[model samples]
Target chain A: ANDDCSKMLLNRCSGCIAVRKSLNSRNISKLLHSCPHRCDHHKIIVEAEDKYKSEVRKSFICNKKILLTPRRRQLRIES
Target chain B: MFRGQRGWFCGSVGQDLRQLWVAEGGTVCDVQAADFLFSCDASHPDTLRIYQSLDYIEDNATVFHAYYLYAVANAEMKTSVALGHFILPPASVQKEIRRKVGGFIWEQDKYFQIEKHDEL
Candidate 1:
């Protein structure tokens, strides 16, 4: 339960685990919440990146059907 | 690869060939309906994807762009694997998806077609 040990544990975990694994953030927060550490900055950055990526992912989601019925191609004749 | 319970019909668990629902899960590895889906396992990494004329999204300038746009956007939500090869971003593969969704078949093949489950 030393300060350095707490920091080491936080370093090994990913921010996504907070929700995916349902781990409480209280302890990790105290160790990292607004603390002047690079992991704190990294967590913020990674979280923001995922949010943006999810948005773009929605933009391409297949909600509409794109069934293409083929048409014979006509050769173009120019004078 | 875990699948959530789907009432007692779609398939049976165990050695039986169970179908996967490509939309419900984020990854394609565990979904049903393998016919409508295909992905390269770690070995054959050089596979390709397509968008059939039957499944092509139309250009924007057309009067039907609004309708056509609505269609592709409304298609079923399959795992990214089903699309990364077909509807993928060009940086991953320099070709346009529409031109290649169904190969160059002029109308004989079943071709690629994405539709809403409601339509089925």
Candidate 2:
């Protein structure tokens, strides 16, 4: 379980990590705890179109890519 | 007891229910009306009553927070500043003591420390 995501593997690519608002970054550990809404390999994201029926939990599938664009609050500092 | 230029008074105790027992040096009392902007006392029935009837600092510089003691885990969850003044409970374990002034940091005696390369 790492916080910096220095060695995260996403689709054989090494860098792209799922950065969710509740998750901050994809570095899951057994004893790791941040938001109660976060769990290993799964997240509950509301589908944007229908705000009412998007209550189901959704898993995020991501790939590692060299994103040259700047991101907001991208620096994930874990507790 | 007059506070000098940049001195801060600090001391706290843990109660049976993890309540922080504050002594005289704490802010709730002894602050001159001109010392603070606002203050808040949380739901400690007996404690709040005693601190209220007493005269308090009336200026805009006064502020108090009486939160569920253990409910607040880390202050960093509430801060986004690189360098600034804030009356916070305590920064996270990952954050190092970077600076100090005017208020009491939960732990650490020295005023400031930088983060990124720090340890608890």
Candidate 3:
């Protein structure tokens, strides 16, 4: 029943346990009510770093996709 | 050794992986000069190519984790294991990583599963 997850290594707490079990047993709307930690998890997963936060615009994510794509290189000559 | 161990984070779990490493007292560094590599999967040959370009060997890189972002979190996809050497993180650090890097949720049953490398 400790709520201090900051120090705890594993999320083996009862809250985390209930959330894991709910994933396969409920709907999003109902799940939201059943667990608030869902929001917390989302925050951790999608959270961005401060350094790049300012660069994240609506089109920034699109740019990320492009950057992630495989790139091909070719030799160039400037004679 | 752990204090300043530099590491690189690649694949879908880049941000999360970087955060986890930093939280664990290890330095999450850029790929250009990294002592360790954390890749989500090995599906992309480019990942391995990058490692090679960095002059790093297989023993220095580990690709054992995959993440699935659900609609609830605004991601439109789920991921599966790819062909490669998949090594789980050290058992000692498993609990810490899981606790901090909360994972995807299954709407059908409404349980939150902390994303970890579930396969060998």
C-alpha TM-scores of all predictions: 0.17, 0.17, 0.30
Q: For model 3, what is the C-alpha lDDT against the true structure?
A: 0.35
Ranking by lDDT: 3, 1, 2
Candidate 3 lands at a TM-score of: 0.30
Better of 1 and 2 by lDDT: 1
lDDT-wise, the better of 2 and 3 is: 3
Q: For candidate 2, give the lDDT of residue B99.
A: 24
- lDDT tens per residue, model 2, B9-106: 12221231112212212233332322321112223333233223212111112122222122122234322211111222112211222221112221
lDDT of 1 by residue, B1-120 (tens): 223322111111111112233233312222121112222111122211211211112210000001111222334632211111121121222222223232211121122232222211
- Full candidate order by TM-score, most accurate first: 3, 1, 2
Q: What C-alpha lDDT, on a 0 to 100 scale, does residue B73 get in candidate 3? A: 32
Q: What share of the true interface contacts does each candidate keep?
A: 0.00, 0.00, 0.03
Candidate 2 local lDDT, residue B38: 17
Per-residue CA lDDT of candidate 1, range A1-79, in tens? 2443334334533431232211111122222233343443234433332343344334445544422234333222321
Query: Against the true structure, what is every candidate's RMSD?
Result: 20.7, 20.5, 17.5
Candidate 3: stretches off by over 4 Å? A1-79, B51-120
- Model 3: per-residue lDDT, tens digit, B65-104? 3232211232232212111112223322333434675322
- When only the first chain is scored, the TM-scores of the models are 0.31, 0.14, 0.20
Model 3 chain B: weakest 10-residue lDDT segment is B77-86
